[model samples]
Target: MNRLVKTALLAGAAWTALSGVALAQNAQPASQEQEATSLGEVVVTARRRAEALQDVPVAVTAVTAQQLENRGSADITELARSTPSLTLNSARGSNSTLISFIRGVGQQDPLWGFDPGVGLYIDDVYVARPQAAVLDIFDVERIEVLRGPQGTLYGRNTIGGAIKYVTRRIGDEPSMQVQGAYGSYDQIDVLANVSAPVSDTLGVSVGIARYLRNGYGTNLTTGNDHYNKDVTAARASVEWTPSDSLFFRVAADWVQDDSNARHGHREFAPILDSAYDTRAGAGDDNHVETRGISLTGEWAVSDTLTLKSITAYRDGTTRGNIDFDNLAGPILDIPAMYDDDQFSQEFQALFEGDNWSGVAGVFYMDATASGAFDTVVGLANLTTLTAGSVDTKSWSVFGDFTYDFTDQLSVSVGGRYTSDEKTGTVFRQQYLGIRSPTFGNAAATLLGSPRTNYTRTREFEEFTPRASVSYKITPDLTTYASWGRGFKSGGFDMRGDAVLYPNTVDGYDPETVETIELGLKGTLFDRFSFATAVFDSSYEDQQITTQYPAGATVASVVDNVGSSSIRGWEFEGSLRATDNLVINGMLSYIDAEFDEFLAYIPTGPLNSTCPTAVGCFVDVSSARNFQNTPEWTGAISATWTHWFADGSEIAFTPSAAYRGAYQQFETPAPLLDQESYWMYDASVVWTGADDRLTIGFHGKNLSDERYKTGGYSFPGALTGDSLIAFYGAPRTFTARVGYKF
Candidate 1:
């Protein structure tokens, strides 16, 4: 074994032994136990079956309710900052633009066919849209973060692993908790959770949370409010347990976000803009409404077999402006209204015998998103162009099985065959600077179809695969290697060329990743545990989008070309420093490149007077880096809890993180550079009598680092060079409180 692996093994063994001894007296944190910070076992279902974190052979990280609360973590973006082999970001202060990458492979585009690189599951139900996965944590049991490509199980999108938010179930006891907080920028949060038994056969629980914040940036031009973010959401669930072998739960959730939206992060200069910005602007009006219902059924068929089924439906509608401009109000136009409806269904049969365990299941998901949006093309006069509806569907059958041939050896294999179909039609495609004869005809002769755009993609399939093996050589340590393949479906890019060119162009084929990982998982010291892994992933058929010239207008579309690869390492561990002190940390590094890529020249010198400009773009660059992906990410946190002689409880957490630089475009111009920066966070918590009352002080962005987040720009066919970029957020803080009964 390598020296690093040997050292890691030795440390893990020592920590486990030490932790066990201290658990007898110390109150340390445990994720699966009923108590807080107590050395207890944590149960996880990432492998399609329940297993202890220590016993599971895969690389995984989990945070319990206590840890999350102590860290003051409430959203997926924050959760990503605390985990290894994970990278998270939001563009324009909207969860709709969430980007998550694992081992340096991820999808950042919000398009019809391109799926999210990471899978987000709440209570075992897959979330449909990226926006729906906001993941507000309340009454949560634990959050399991599985790293690597999980193409073998848990359905599709599992390529970059998955995040499972396990919530508190309806138990036999009645419980209640209420919390409220107020902080800088007029930020306010209120939350409540209550649980009760309806009868001997039924149990019910309800949770509600409200978050509000006033504008943080002052607009110098229009005196408008900017940086205003708010959300109000609630959830209710009912559990039914009639027999010893069967259990069922039904849940409903709703969320409404109301805030005056300003322009997204705008760029003042190249390589100088961060993604998060608090700029003041005019035309501040943006809002969203989302609601969903889900039902889950679990049955223990026998001591060795179990069955699970999950079904859900969700709806969302949004209005107001999406992009804010620095130019005239012409740059400040509102998007046509848009609504989204999605449905998901899944079933799995799992078996766990003495030497064999596996799960088999089928999953189906579909979403239809239709929105109205306007585009600008004139130089002196502002023209508003409109676009209309889009839809898509996907389904798959997947399974995985593992068997132990002996006490020290085990092997597992898994795969999924997924099929996807998508279609869309533009009702009122506007040619901002030109005249149009027709808009709805996808087949209009390049001469008459100017009013509408029609595009359709159908019947695409992906076959993802997974394999792994593990061996326990000693009582305290185990080593393993895994191989998995991930897939991302290809579809239309709505923002590419704008309305002139319809989407009828062929959407690119799906992309794939072949990842191989090796790692060790162990516990030692009676007080510590650790996991480390190294991976190499090869990617193929990368996607690219560009503007296509059609007569007097520009129509943008997407296509796939070339290949690439990436290599990375990840390690994480936790220590019970003392009876009252806990320390945990994670680190990751990725080296990514374009082994092969096709970059099309987006624009060329054109007549400045023409309202519509287009050039015959050519593939000028090959094998280029992808967009919005960084190479390294790491985080560390320490939490210390203490009890007063008078019986009051107090806890504190200090945490920090850093993300390495990466390129903004597949073939970046001289103006673009990779992002490299770090951030810090900390929280202080107090517990009152019988843990009924609690007050907490929390602060985020302690580092106050300035960075750029999303979007890209290139030279236009017209006179102006395409200068598109957004600024990231600056350091901010807030204080919060909660009560329990």
Candidate 2:
């Protein structure tokens, strides 16, 4: 840890020295002067309306296409490393199923009934399922990440924040772009986009991308590798403009993934082996498919008012088999599959008045989720299968109104009333004879029913509200404070089997959060832009999943854990150090803890809370913190672009990110605590004389830092070695070339 800090400090000093020298040499502009003096303004739609980043009161970071390309970012996980107060995680080694954490709130399990704390959207269309949320970046204009509660504007399950991916529109001129990259671990990526106008009133756009990489590690027992990636995606869109006041667009996309399951290292093995070695004897045959379509229409009713509508539908599926034990013989194996679909419609009216500006919207969504997984033990032909399905219908009415009393002072208020109805059925069965007589009556005693089937229906509703006030101290500076509420719907715990105490199909209660935030935004020296925010949030009825004792065994169930709170601050900025140099920095600090929490934990190296010799259930409330909550995280980067007298240019960018150590679970287990780590990345690009062709070299994790992102475990009474962990990727390098015409 000390070494990393020293390296970062040295790099900062070196950059500072270089900046001074560069500024002295380029004091007088040889090229354009306007571009050399001030940083470009960043525009965002954080408030459901287009506004300058400095003018909006919310804490947001807008990542441009050039910034993404410079970092060689392919997915949300890579992009998150460069942002403040945000983290991305993947469960069971499947990138298609993502987990996002913002301000200590997120869903760890991508199950059928659970809801995500953060909202995800593509061009204002919400994505309802985590199975389809891991979208690849292609032909995107920008990505906006809004921190803190956004339930009033985004509606439902936005207790943490929201992420928006906005794609570029089809232009009138014919254009094409092609890019390809090759890197370590036999990785290959390709992307192509083309747009053309068919006539004066119609235009079309198309994009395709393919990413392939070999596994980073090999299985010693089966001679097969894991963590490989094989994915492909395609998108098409059409735009129509029949009149000057009316516009419409329709788009469709398809994606497919065929990769191996996530691999893990044995925690209590006899031999201390290499970190990447695996002993699983069976193959992790994983596959996923996704398809979606959207239609958007807009009409200008008047000069100050406009109406917009969006309709969308999406379907996705995932299938995989995993060797949970990670042993040569595979004592425990899991085969899983899931399928989901969703349809949604939304309408909005935007109004701009002399003293007031606001937006009103109505939204409707219907979704279905289903999945099943089997537990196969040893060479026994016996299998315990758990299957379930859920159907959900949701509706909401939301509005936001802002009134300006003066040119320098304004206040805004908003609220959303949302309701959801959900129904589901669970079925549990053993294909053959029960493995043990002790496990035969799994559900009979707990639910007073046979281990056959159970049906349940539930309804949840909430009214979330928001209010804020801002004062423009100066034309270039703004200060604001806001208060808001967020809510997540109730759902059943599908992991409960016959051996569990909560075997009945009872739904959990909804969780809610209230937050207060203070912020400042301004421009300095006409060359630097900065934003800062301090916030506090209180959480109630936080949903938690844990093991519950039935008789002689334990079953997994979901329940309302307890209350919690979090306070944090963040600052982000960009500086035009020189005519051709730009420097950016982001820093964050958070203090998050559970005010009250009680749960059962497996007796292992990371926990010492079991009450009995065989690991008995006990309350572990006052001994731990929230899962995956890091105290401090931030990133810094510098870019230098120098244009030659002949108009060609070369650029170099160096970036680094740091994350403080934090607990991976709500336990006192040392194995679940990840240590602090740092990652370094850099890129160099050169543009051709015609400015139509480009080439670049990039490297990620240049220091080869190895860290654990997630893990799995069993009770000490169930297995001799109960814990295993998954590690992040190692150092990788890539070279790329691109052409635009």
Candidate 3:
């Protein structure tokens, strides 16, 4: 008893035998409008106003587009596996290198002046580097997810929350849709969209997607197959309302990712036997490309005021290789590249009165980034190459306010003021005895020196605030309380901090948070629905990075390392339970820690708790918490639909998700935790009867389970084989077809 409570009581008896076989096949019955008495009104814009996700008071999770194509979610780590406090990873094998953690903050080294406590947007712009934030959930029309601090109306690094990606517009009439899928390794997916109406006020739309696969490990020394996939994406939009107070919208997008390389495996061995025979003798590959454009305008200035504007530009590039000693020679190798560009602008003014309403905004951004990397050590080839360039500029002003002293009470307030500036330039090179020439001048006089250039600059400012209160006790319930503040900014650490002093390249400061929440949202008897939230956050100057051991190579630094806290809760529910059953559930709990950290511990044993021997920074703050956070997460689903008698319909969905043990770096070595897992997914569909042909089948994990979403640690003094990890994806199935016009 007590092996994590007997594996959570055998995963709660396999979720009660899968919810008693989906409530005994929906226990028959009929009518009553197919039992759905409530749980419909979702609509959200989180607070850029468009309410009703139970009248928003924060804590969101939208997810639409038919629930992301019925859970076959295309990207962003498959919509973070149905969002149970979201956690995603793709780093190393670059699916555009995404690494997102929510509720426990984010940014786990997409390295380039790290920043990203979860915030990514599209439509409200803002998607500044995580190597251009792993988008690709094409044509989406929903995906809100605003969990904790969204700094006074989504401004800056949202302290662990914010993800919008609302697309799908431009429509007046005509339409077309197409989809295709095939699976299990020969995988392929395709999608298309079209919309029409070109005058009488204009409208247009276009979308496309492509995904190809064939790779699940098999690099037994360059026989190729290190996570293969070639991705493609596209989008376009246009809309104009030539009158009725003017309006306009324009959009553009593009993405590409040609993959291979990201099969780190090597879980302790010279060549273990599992991860499908992983070896990758360095013929690695990875590529990424992105493009963007946006424009929006609106004016109505009189039916209760309104004015808006948005402009954007984005660019990206990333190239890679990271066989990082997964064995097969070349000691430890890593090849990297990155390039970036950004531009932004925003303006807003909104109003409504009767008791008040609000919105106000102004924003500006500029960016540029550059990268280079090469690190190969040992085997008589010690080389290092590092390069950097960064430039950033920012500005902001924001506001949000709401009042309604009656009609069920309300209160809201928001504020934001930000400023940021960053600049950097760096370069370094080292090579010793690259083929002997008198041992290359005595190993370049003991490991090269001289080809160091530096420049750094920084500036930052912040003012974040938010407040909320709500009540509506019955009109279908609602209750709320909130407070917020969050900011993240501070840069420079493009490696080069060999203990500061003259090795120059320092600057690590801003990281702040403050949050409090309490919530409830409801609807009951009308067939049930619920939501709950509880949070407490605090953190300050909490930026920490370490990778010490430099002499035989390995250096990464960044500091501020102290202070942290988090407490959480979330509960969600739904039920219809008959007339064709429906049930949904979610539960999450977090307890992140590190209330005063002291970093430096990437692998152990260097006695004396020394101040140095090669590395040592102790105080691991009671040892671990917060890193891909998962203090019990859960999800459940059940759906069924059936109708016939010529009108066609068939649907079935079964889902399960669970995560408990977690840790993927915050240095807790032992292959970096990640246990307690469970995943199962299923789907089925068939339609026709004027629904414009459809068919489907999907399966995932389905109990095959073998997990680890990420990990890295090469100790044995830098790879003589020591922990590499990164596996997730096994058991898959797919089949699909669709059409409409």
Candidate 4:
């Protein structure tokens, strides 16, 4: 059978198995209860059953809708800002796909074969492809960010971590809300949501959001400033309850985004010399279009059993000329890079009562993509390359069970056996064959090879398991411990133009993480709550995919020799000092390094002439701390609200963060030591119209800290030559209006 057909068959088989399991679950026994309070000891579906967060014994952080809005975080990147134990990395720039690292592990390459280390799920359905994840969060019930390797329970995208955006489902209500905001940098955002019942057994909800912003940097050439973006999204859902025992809901969404970059840089001067590089110039645009639909069903066959099924599909396209340099560096131009990922997935399982529950199901996913690239030097073309298609299929069977030894003590265990098949073919007709470049001959070679043709296929079967134990020592306190395995798949590197090494197919090795962690979750004085955890994780065969040489078209890959471990501690607490005074804070620290890293310079241009190549592979025999990982990162926030004798209220919230400096590349000199930065953000709100409306004025970055929040250096481009960093957004003011009925 053809590879694609085989992949499809396996995927279908997994889903079919899940469907049968769900059917069986519908025929078992169940549990029903009234919804719990927002900040109480709520249960998490991540474990395949409803268990209190403190009772799960896993490293997880949950954020509510109110908190998200208060922080003005609309998308994944923004969400990562406040999320502890997490950091965001990018290959292209600001608008590029996000690579999230939890406990310092993740993939940073934006290639056809490399998938994100972190997984994003909506409801119980997995959003299988990365491109489809570009959509923003509009109306959400809550967001749960799970750290550590979730291999056993969450499966595939959970190799590093998992992010579940649980949207607000149809509740017992009829309501409507509208909100709008205008901000500095010529920003505007509008949102509206409406929910109602069509019949006693049916209901529907609809939401829409529009966002736009003008450039924050000047377009040296167009004089027509850019770097601004505009996005519009719409979501609608229909829910039906045929009887007290059955429920079904389906949702669909659409989004389109268009934006450009104000590619700027610091030359000898930031004013007169606009360092205009065509590749980084304003004529280029980065854009994406997305469409997604999903369906969910719930059936209570008996008082003791409940069955659930979740299915989702997404189709998307991304096109952009991601500029490498800001006219201030040697990074080359990446023009017309195109990508598309079509995803389809389904999950099914059964649930028993809260005291004892077991869930068994299968997961399947298929992702395919193709891309093109045009590399030029100073508007004059150097190489025109094309990359072929890549197809990936992943399937797994997973099960989780929890047994309550007593009302206060229980143990839960889950495991997943996964099989992954990947196939890719990159052809470079002329590009790969060029030896001595004669302008005419090189162009001819490039056209012939188009690019070097590389076809690779790899398959892996892995078993990951997790077990946890929790105990309620007291009514207000709970403590637990857990351990699990997580893994990232291996893939071939992207070789667009005729790279320095035509045979350099630095295939990655799957990174493995084994975590042992303990934590405490407690509520004190009836007005304060906190959770603290300390963990040690060992990473084997670490895949370093972000270390591309400066000016190189592809990222450099390396594997750890001995083994690496990361140990860290995290503590978060919130105090309601009074009815009108509240304070919250979080602190995190991590220590990560290579037990041993046997580095070697392959026979390539990178090892041929840097500082005479005297110490080409010198570090291979030693151990060193991992580069680019901050040792300490945390934040503190406080907000207070006061009411006058009248019907109006005002509030103030201030936030701050601290991050330790780190070097990007493992270089002796020319290091990019990203200095630590501290920032403050605050907002004030006023309400009127008998509490039906609210108007607010807010200013983020109250102290316009001019610092680089993120960055990386490419090795192929030469150390420090193409080093780039994303500067923190400048302080801005915003005004908002909202109404509810």
Enumerate clash totals for all models, in the order shown.
Answer: 46, 6, 0, 35
Provide TM-scores for the models.
0.86, 0.90, 0.35, 0.85
For candidate 2, the clash count comes to 6
lDDT of 1 by residue, 1-741 (tens): 343454355445544544454355443444331133222256777787887665566678888887788777767667767777676676433543466766666666543334677887777777655654566776689888887777667655666777788888877988888888787778788899999998998999999988877665644445665666678889899999999999999999888777665455445432223343433333456677878899999999899889999999988876655443443344333343557788998899998889999999998888887665554333422233445455778888998898999988989888899888877554444443322222222332232344555566556788888888988766556678777887776666554443343333444677777877777666554456667777777777766655433333344556666677676677777777776777777777667777655544344556553223543334344546656566778888888878788778788889888877776556564444546788888899888857777788888888777666654453443312334454554566767777777
lDDT of 3 by residue, 1-741 (tens): 222343344334434543453344423333553533343367787888677788678878777777667666657676666665788777744556778888888778886656778888887888888763677677788888888878778877888888888888876788989988999989988888998988889888888888898887678887887666888888888899999998898898888888776757877766566664577575667788888998999898797888999999998887777766677776776677788888999898988888888998889898888887756665646766677887989898999888989888899888999999999887766666332222123444235563556788889899998999988887777777788898888887776644332324666778888877777676655666667677777877777766644555566767777888777677766677676777777887777788788775544565778544455566778875677888878888887888898989888888888888887877676665778888989888887878898888889888878787776776755445546777777888989898988
Pairs of residues clashing in candidate 2: 442-498, 443-498, 606-668, 606-669, 606-670, 607-669
Model 1 Cα shift for residue 636 (angstroms): 2.2
Better of 1 and 2 by lDDT: 2
Model 2 agreement with the true structure over 1-741: per-residue lDDT tens digits: 442343344334433543453344323332352233221267888888877777777888888777787667778777668777897877755756778888888887887767899888888888878875777778888999999889899988889899998999999899999999899999999999999999999999999999999888877777766777889999999999999889999998888988677657776664336666678754667788988999999998897898999999999998876665677663555667889999999999998889888899999999999998765455444456677888889999999989999999999999999999989787765554323223342432222334647788899999999999999988877888888999888887776664343334676888999888877777655666677777778899888876432322235767777888787778777777777887888888778888877564433343466544433345456786877778999989888898888878888989999988877677655775688999898999888788788898988899988888887766453332546677778889999999999
What's the residue-level lDDT of 628 in candidate 2? 79
Decide which is better by lDDT, 1 or 4: 1
Alpha carbon lDDT of each predicted model: 0.66, 0.77, 0.75, 0.64
- The sequence of per-residue lDDT tens digits that candidate 4 reaches over residues 691-737 is 67888777777787765544444433322234445554678888988
Candidates in descending lDDT order: 2, 3, 1, 4
Best by lDDT: 2
Query: Candidate 1: where is the Cα deviation over 4 Å?
Result: 1-40, 93-97, 111-114, 269-282, 332-336, 378-390, 426-428, 431-448, 495-504, 545-555, 602-623, 669-675, 712-728
